[model samples]
Target: MRDLTVAVFRPDDERLEDAVELIDSLGATAVPDPMLAVEPTGSPPRTDADCVVLTSKTGAELVADAGWEPGEATVCAIGPRTADALREVGYDVDTVPEEYTSSGLVATLEGAVDGARVEVARSDHGSPVLLDGLEAAGAYVHETVLYRLVRPAGSGDSTERAAAGTLDAACFTSSLTVEHWLEAADERGNRDEALEGLTEATVGVIGEPTRETAADAGIDVDLVASEATFDALACETVEAAAPTYHE
Candidate 1:
């Protein structure tokens, strides 16, 4: 009965540290491998839109730090965290979808955005679902790339562990993290072995898009967390890997 070793791929920020701590508290050994790094693009969302959508907390913080204010525009955040970030920066969050995904925002704003200008501000890797959905719903949409998510250098240790079949489980928070993890594995010539090893491991993902990416990449996902939070993802994965973790 050894502690479950779960690999977590988050950006090298407080989020990564939080993931490690959460896994440790779950009685698991966390292999912290940062697969995503945020590089600010220095572009801010235009304030003239009828409605503004901020996707990630990082996007909200970046735009606010750059002094980009959403004036009179209905402020919409894709998730509660994004909403909190917006509110923390002296902005009003007028809308937050219940689902907290790109499609969720589309559904929440579709009726109101007809013939209105909608500005979507987020990372370059943001799913096209939100933009395409909004466009289909008849909103004149604009996108602002607040930052780019890049794979940090030397981030493939988890891939190596996976290739060796040492990792018991993994928690992936985004589609980009899943893609980056496989990319890192491919770079280390362990893509095939790593992929194979993952078949035996419990793979937990946060969102539908991430699950789709993992499925498309030929990875078997064992669970999709009931919620998109890291705590749910890590706890569910650790429990699946070691059922007695909480007991």
Candidate 2:
């Protein structure tokens, strides 16, 4: 099979190194073009809650930066990555759902949060599924917007390359990545072309929510990770593109 060019849109950090390793493992060229830039909005509130829910690594980083004490609170993360982030900051994660979506977390935390105080820390653009579900389950939910998602300045290049079908596949970890990429494509005056190009190259999403988000935005997703993790997404992308390269 021919070597493939896989565009990675993760942040420029250790996570990006992980993505590059995965791409190299698949014998693909890693395109290190970060699409979204995360900035902490402000210090998160220190709450004396019974449990704390972190949905993303960024949220975990924000909470750690705020020097909030977990105290006796049960720390629940959405997935292994978030759990690892929390653990890196001296908080032991109590629960990580089998599935890694907000709906999945709500399902896993159903009876556990009843009549408990739960704090949710995530991005400003996060969905309210977990918060609403916890509130419905009788938890006093305190929500905090830890970070905001912004498009980096040079992200337009990758969007244009994707639109022009110059890349073999594009891996998207979050719904906001897809949104921002398309928005940048539109701003570059090739929204339609970019959407068409997405159909030509493989589109690998991290999970179901991101797949749905891409579909809603009129992009057909070619691959979805069984687990909502970057490694799984990278594997799925390579598997989805293998047949094309061999043919």
Local accuracy by lDDT, each model: 0.89, 0.85
Name the lDDT of candidate 2: 0.85
TM-score of 2: 0.94
TM-scores of the models, in the order given = 0.95, 0.94
Cα lDDT tens digits, model 2, 1-247, are 4468788989878888888988998888888778888888886855798988888887887788788888888889998889988898878889999988898999999888889999888888787788899899999999888888898886767777777778788899888898888888888998998888878888899877788999999999987888888898888898888777753
Q: What lDDT score is found at residue 7 in candidate 2?
A: 85
Count: clashes, candidate 1: 0
Clashing pairs in 1: none
lDDT winner:
1
* Candidate 1 lDDT tens digits, 8-38: 9988888889889999998789999999999
- Looking at model 1, residue 246 earns an lDDT score of 30
75 in model 2: Cα distance from truth in Å? 1.0
Residue 142's C-alpha lDDT in candidate 2?
A: 93
Model 1 Cα shift for residue 221 (angstroms) = 0.6
